[model samples]
Target: RPIFWVGNERTTDHIHSILTESEPWFEFDTSRLEYINRIKFWRYLLGNESFDADYWLTRVENDFE
Candidate 1:
């Protein structure tokens, strides 16, 4: 499974610490995990357009799948 760490810097750093501590117990490859800032993730999803609830929902669903 792929793990997406999406949050601000502080939260992401906290997540990173947790992941590092638990890496030895993880069954899957840790390399597959990714750390993406929330702002960048939103930018990637929204592109140059304004916010659309349906579009955001659909994009998140499709991308996760």
Candidate 2:
């Protein structure tokens, strides 16, 4: 059978796990889709560290509280 994310908790966990898989195929289409669909808000609020923690953290310290 197949697994599916039911609600928000299961959904978010599934997403994080999928990113960790880190397959090449996952990186382009799948990852981009994930970013656009689920992660876009983070990029908007956090910008790219949305994905990059190093850049993001420094940016936060410099730009935000």
Candidate 3:
């Protein structure tokens, strides 16, 4: 499995140092943090058994507008 590091420059630098010390398919970048967060949010919502469809629908509509 590959480990992706997505964060600001400082954090990426820190993670790069750690990964260099214990390398394991590391890929570091300082971007797409927002996209990654949205992916995680949707994954959590879809995976939850007690998902609130109405709430998320309203939230998504509001987010788009």
Which residue pairs collide, candidate 1? none
Indicate whether candidate 2 or candidate 3 has the larger TM-score. 3
Q: After superposition, how far is residue 55 of candidate 3 from its true place, in Å?
A: 27
**Per-residue lDDT for 1-65 in model 3, tens only?**
23565444333344223322422443443223333444446558679533332243344435542
In terms of lDDT, the best-performing candidate is 2
TM-score versus the correct structure, for each prediction:
0.19, 0.22, 0.26
**Once superposed on the true structure, which residue ranges of model 1 sit more than 4 Å away at CA?**
1-36, 49-65
Q: CA lDDT, every prediction?
A: 0.39, 0.47, 0.40
**Clashes in model 2: which pairs?**
none
lDDT of 1: 0.39
Q: So what's the TM-score on candidate 1?
A: 0.19
* Deviation from native of the Cα of residue 28 in model 2, angstroms: 17
Each model's backbone clash number: 0, 0, 0
Q: Give the poorly placed runs of model 3, Cα more than 4 Å off.
A: 1-31, 48-65
Tens-digit lDDT track for model 1 on 1-65?
23565455333344334323434454544422322233235547669334323243345446542
Give model 2 RMSD, 1 decimal: 7.9
Give the residue spans of candidate 2 off by over 4 A: 1-35, 49-65
